[model samples]
Target: MIKIPSKRKRGVIISGQGWQRLQQAKRKMEMQGNAGESYTLEELSKITRLSSNTITKVQRRKFPVDKQTLESFFKSFNLTLIDSDYAEAIDAPPPVNRERIVLGGQIPLDSLLYVERPPVESLCYEAIVQPGALIRIKAPKQMGKTSLMARVLQQAREQNIRTVTLSFQLADTQVFLKLDRFLRWLCAIASSQLGLPKRISESWDNIFGSNYNATYYFENYLLREMDSDLVLALDEVDEVFHYPEITADFLGLLRAWHEKSRYGDGGSVLWQKLRIIIVHSTEVCVSLPVNQSPFNVGLSVELPEFTLEQVQDLSERHGLKWKVDEVERLMALVSGNPYLTQLALYHLSNEEITLDELLKTAIAEDGIYGSHLQQQLWRLRRYPELLADLQRVVLSPSPLEVEPIQALKLQSLGVVRVQNQRVSPRCELYARYFKLALAIT
Candidate 1:
């Protein structure tokens, strides 16, 4: 039986073999009269203006050659590397068990709903030398906004795009009062992700040095330090809208950077070389006008709930043996809600329960759907009149304008859908939960 060497030992052996192969290739080219046509390493370095050390590293398989170096090398041979076999070999394998319950840092998988966006990796090559465009993903809670952002960052890395993802979810509530700390944290995160050699504190100090205004520092230093176009995704941006003054100031800086990149001299703006993607749950209100805000500067992408077909696909992916009829029945119950659909599927997958049993258990006293129902009830406690108004709207065949706020809130929660002055529960599951919550409350 052949036994493989340990990873470190194998790496050394493989690298040596690869280096020998490269030398052999060079020899074959020379025998084929290509020696006079192709430049030597030193000669190629002089022509491409790259150091000999860089060429030596590539030949030794110490590190992958930069795109420019590889391009120059190919150009020397009157060939292109765009469709080379070596380029395909550089791609890493996808992660095993890519599907998981929890995604990103804290979002539960059952709650996530994947939406198709412009593939993030493709943008890297297209925007390599140009100012990267902004991406705005707008969605409601439990729609998988954070998970999608995580996937985008992963895709960016696979495409050799330098990427950084910062979530405002963990930002201190005191961010409004302590702008400097907020700025420092943002810089530290960017620095860490970029593998910058400088310490976070040093980088921060260098950018903000004795200057209280962080806006200038971010535009001038932090953005400038990004050697290549970076894909920076900021999640939970709507959370900042609670602090209007800070939100306006920060977003204004982003707008300024974008504008400068468009109209100013080449080196005047850092955003000319940085790609920014901002994601947020829709807010009830905003400090800046929706159209005029910097948040609106990018392509505004909305993530919707899965269609019936998608829900079935998700169930199949989870290893659930769901029939078309079963899938339709479940969709009728959950109204294609990505989260609740998966939650039900998970329980069904774990336990040998019939559809009727699952439905009954969910609505029974102190059951799974019961708690969710009660929580919505608790939210309504502060406004009993609103709750009563909603109950009336639900019971009434026709919708009334008197309960617009209650109706809007219910619709936002994915509990009810309004159509042609008629009010209807989105699905049987939601209806059961709402009824249970009202009953116990």
Candidate 2:
């Protein structure tokens, strides 16, 4: 009788070290020979004389490819393929709920599922070490803004620097009623995070304005108390944007601190010890001079959606051996939205749903994305103007040009995409879901 091999032994995947070596070689080649631009899948396919699917499989290490395919990929990059670089593919283990909580919110620091967006992580890590650096991370909801912020804070901690993270979402409505109350709350929160006493109230002066008092508190107390540099990460800054009364003043105050770090006539040394990380979900709609706006200054990081390759990488990390076509089919509906992709993979990894079943019920109320889509619908219902504008975009046969402010707001909400002042539904799922949700008869 002839012996047959098991399914797990039928193919091979590149090891972690192998993937790193291969990526480094590819990046070096891109820099030296390709004008530093990353080669697209098509460009890579042409160079390797392999199908794009095979290249993706070799690079992503999700689905296994033939040994000859790996050898070809290695040869194209001028590297030799070795046995240690590849391993026999193993069947994925069953999912554990404790480790695979992909419902929503920031991914944990040590989670294998957190896929880096390349230069973005490197940029944030580098920016935080500079004196008085202000790094702004902007993206729509669930685009991993907070997750990135958490990593940045971790990076700061690794450098032996002090770090504090405060989200405006945690602030009470009464806190925004007055600028003084808000500033005091900020200082108090930072103090607590830093293990300092709430001394702001003791030093508070009604005679001086809120901005002045807040600056004085930070410069004199917070900075003086810190042994190393301080990283003040402010998340959900868009909450502050809702209140025009304190938005300009608070942002201007941050700008002032940034400017003081570089151009302070006398206090530059004291202010230099401070670094600010601002994370927001929307564009700054309020008007302010260029010099006074912190949004334009500093290392601005705008988080983008995942690409097809990144989605594949994430799927592999989830222990799902998804093929290129399956990934494309999923992306066709969600278009690489990070949260949606992760949620889909989470369920699939748990063996709860099939891809066919998922696609069919995607827009239904009881689907995996049901609550998420309902949240978006509720948000739109709150703003009639935005609701009407979105309805027009979804109902139209093509992209529509709405009011510029409306376009900005809608794009920020992640409901639509705006390019060259024209707006369209963000994905086919959004279009189909919202068309029914909004009752666009």
Candidate 3:
């Protein structure tokens, strides 16, 4: 079968030498088939009557090579994973570039180190194609929220739906000064992205409020003209929470548009032509009228931390030949935080540090997380209450009861986890590092 890049690409090496040999054998079977013609992994799996995913794992050589797998390869392709071939496979090394760990910033489509999260990715996909659908994804920093949004937008393009992405973080300080100006700016950008001219301002009337003007522009001009549904994705929507006035009006407007789609009245046509995807952090503390709040509606999704299975898969992608215990030990420290786990594994896979060394110095001044921990320290100083709350959490050996709002604020910082009414450091690393940093006894 053909060799597909292992999906478990994080700080990983081939966890087992025997597994790597199986992968080579699978590749060879495809390459040497039908008088030197090759077959795709899927095609080979079909010929052998094996599950495609099983064939893919074999081709990737992701797990330990065993008698059954080797025998299956022989039956499928009349090939062997033994003798000289086996000897050569055992000696072959993993790709050198696999050690590069992605820590922060947007994870490129090619570099995303996640297993396809189900129901979440799939639900977002379903929402994008539906008429007038809005999807909200909430998660703290480094939790892969934006990465998933990128994928959803990609799916929209594949479906021939038009897409426009706007980031609130990139908006000008002056834009948030007034709702009209902000709405107009939004319209201008959307129009520009849609290859339309700046005609939104030409229709602005003094008699109409900016909110109405913005609605008129989208309904009478932009959305009205588009052949396919236009997907408007707003990332970091919570940035406006600090500007309560703008957030209340702007988000309320979004809620109005969303509600209109369900009206089934004559006005439904324009609203149905537009779909919105909003990304925000649940740590947002804003006061808005419950009746007008958009947060209450739409397909809301919260990203959960990676499970152990996913962490293991990502470790393998990094080319690390980690055993189950090694993976569990790492998780015990990082607790499957995607960025943190990948960081630890990267150091291990590339020989920058050993796993024991990583744990020993994970949050020290000269360690992998020195910069990260320092930033958190600086941020907490600005919010003494949060710093105090976290100090109490780290001081305790077990989860501590914290106010719901306080727990959310802590979780947003990526240092705490909350279940029910209790909160604790997100992982052992956070617990150990912060205990000293905060001087919590």
Tens digit of per-residue lDDT, candidate 2, span 139-224: 88888999999988876785678999999999999999899999999999999999998898777899988999999999889998
Name the candidate, 1 or 3, with the larger TM-score value: 3
lDDT winner among the candidates? Answer: 2
Return the lDDT, model 2, position 383. 75
> Which residue pairs in candidate 1 collide?
101-109
lDDT of each: 0.57, 0.86, 0.75
lDDT of 1 at 97: 50
Local accuracy of candidate 3 as per-residue lDDT tens digits, 1-441: 967554432221122333334334545654576443445434666787776445544434333344465566655555554542322123234565543545776666545354455447656766787899989899888888888898788767856789999998989999888888888889999999999887975879969898888888888888888888889999988777768778778988999889888898988977897889989875556676887877888799888887776777677777878888988988988887877876777777778898898878888899988988888788678777888899899999889998788888788878898987899898888888899988842
Q: Please identify model 2 stretches exceeding 4 Å from their true place.
A: 1-98, 264-266
Model 3 Cα shift for residue 297 (angstroms): 1.8
Better model by lDDT, 1 or 3?
3
- Ordered list by lDDT, greatest first: 2, 3, 1
Please count the clashing residue pairs in each candidate, in the order shown.
Answer: 1, 0, 10
Q: Output the better candidate (2/3) by TM-score.
A: 2
Candidates arranged by TM-score, highest first: 2, 3, 1
**lDDT computed for candidate 1:** 0.57
Reference-based lDDT, residue 130, model 3: 85
Q: Which of the numbered candidates is closest to the native, going by highest TM-score?
A: 2
